[model samples]
Target: MAKQTPMMQQYLEIKAQYEDAFLFFRLGDFYELFFEDAKKAAHELEITLTSRGGTHDRIPMCGVPYHSVDQYIQQLIEKGYKIAICEQVEDPKEAKGVVKREVVKLITPGTVMEANLLNDKENNYLATVADFEDGSFGFGRTDLSTGESAVTLIEGDLNDVIYELASISAKEVVVSEAFASKYEDTLEQQLNLTVSVEEERELPESMEGLCSELEQSKLIETMAPLFHYLIKTQKRSLDHLQKVTYYSRNEYLKIDYHSKRNLELTETIREKKKQGSLYSILDKTETSMGARLLKKWLEQPLVDRKKITERHSVVQSLLDNFFIREELKDKLKEVYDLERLAGKVAYGNVNARELVMLRRSLHQAPSIRIM
Candidate 1:
């Protein structure tokens, strides 16, 4: 019937493990998809979704050259899909059976590292909860999307976590066993999260409120036996929440949609910076988050124009003024505050990069002293 390549068997196995994610099966020169994955990939990728060696009928097939897989992967992830990048760990030319294929990386909407999938101006948040007693131990949140983050130590009863989760709006979450038990009851309640109780850290039942948080956050990973899911929610009512002083309004400033109408429109940037062709830009090299940020910035430069200009000038000055790019880069590396960087970039502080472009503006060539 059909030629069942050894790789196909391995693909099936890996697919079983990651039902939520599409398997980007890596072969010699192409990354292929089979069965329904093929149909889906074909429609989404808009490329030829053909089939491989025909069987009793035909095995569905769709593929992209290994070199071009990045673009395809970026698209799938942006579509809110999880992608299990199954790569060939062994040399396909020499391997005997199915040329070993194992998932090298799993790119979910919440945890993606591709430069093409991130924004330099916004945060990609991942939240975690630890409820020891009443399902309100609060949460620890980080968003590397824009390389900036925000976290709130929740108070109140069990429902407080829900409000906090809604406020923070993180994409993924990890819960402790003690906290999961606190997840809220009321089956009719829906907040949007993947909740999984930890088996090893099992705590008493007082923290049942945390269960809602777990369910909404999708408890992406478990320390013992965790659960995971995609977070999708829009309803927000910040009730029974207290504010912490460690935060400044600068961190919470909003960029109006009308203002962000032209920061770095992906298509425009690509066209203008395409070097030879009008269809090219450095965007292909940027992560999805970064792309979104650039687009957002392009759409609303005035939101924080002053800071944005600063970062812009910094980078431009460096490229135009110095030759010590590497040494200056080391200095920029000293900056530990991504949120601060994001603020500067959002406000058009493009010159911030100048501080590290060619040399350290801070260290300088030794200031001359007057006699």
Candidate 2:
């Protein structure tokens, strides 16, 4: 048996906290991976796998340069792998034996905010499911990039939960340990969703305001796990997160999962591509926000005749005025994704370029309103 190095000991301590994710341990100018993380990342990233001399034997090691780490991270994210970015908190010169390191960020498929990694036209949702003792389930979802949160109480079984998740194209799902043990395989293998477990069901006091509109305890319980998971993984101010919107299946036209797929409403059933879908054909939206809204409308058609007629009347008015419609489209094209930009601002990650975009987008608001 050999004693572990001080650096290795620190790495192990931090890695234990994020055992399910690839830990990118910062060393010098590189973000290194060791042992199993090293081997998997090396194979998945096609990076050179090397070895470091340990007290007993050679230890597997691989790393990517810090400057070019985003590309590697993007690749792993596309494959649905979570990454814990552990950075050296203190300078090496100031350290006693080993420099202090901590995980600054945990990038999951659902929680990604990088512009290059996200699809501008589509939302990436992180969902949470709560199994009630009465056979009903509470399903909550949030798009971290846009800070949009919503939840619904499904008076059905796990298949209904799956249908809701599939319809929304959730990238990852959070559940309790018991729920994970029972249905993790179906979620991961069948739907290809990344499953995360959270045991906390109590909603935090800071986030109580977000659920003020909800009266049902079940809905609040569902959102609590999701809110806690966000607090844990994001470790940032979620002020931009909107008030949780509660919806019912009766609010929308009832469409089963198989029926939605067969209808080719959003994507083709055969190729599962959006190019040949009804959404692709009907979509003439100028901004990313509009595109996302259009997709949501297609998935959840209005059941209320009054609401449907109101929407149709608005469309008809636009159709009647070509010049105004064209001007509105032009103004919309000049705008950026305000939803996500606001999220970044709330998360305190907004950069100078994004600020410039935000300014430009805001500048067009008056003209858009006049039209």
In TM-score terms, which candidate is top? Answer: 2
Question: Candidate 1: which stretches are off by over 4 Å?
Answer: 1-5, 129-137, 144-151, 156-169, 175-371
- After TM-score superposition, the amount by which residue 77's alpha carbon in candidate 1 deviates from its true location, in angstroms, is 1.6
Assess the local accuracy of residue 288 in candidate 2 as a C-alpha lDDT between 0 and 100: 91
What is the TM-score of candidate 2? 0.97
124-243: candidate 1 lDDT, tens digit per residue? 555656654443454555443243333344445545556445444445565655545545332114444444333444422322332333432322122112112212120112111111
CA lDDT, every model vs. true structure? 0.51, 0.93
For model 1, the run of ten residues with the poorest summed lDDT:
232-241
For model 2, residues 58-79, the per-residue Cα lDDT tens digits are 8899998899999999999988
lDDT of 2 at 120: 89
- Total clashing residue pairs per candidate? 81, 0
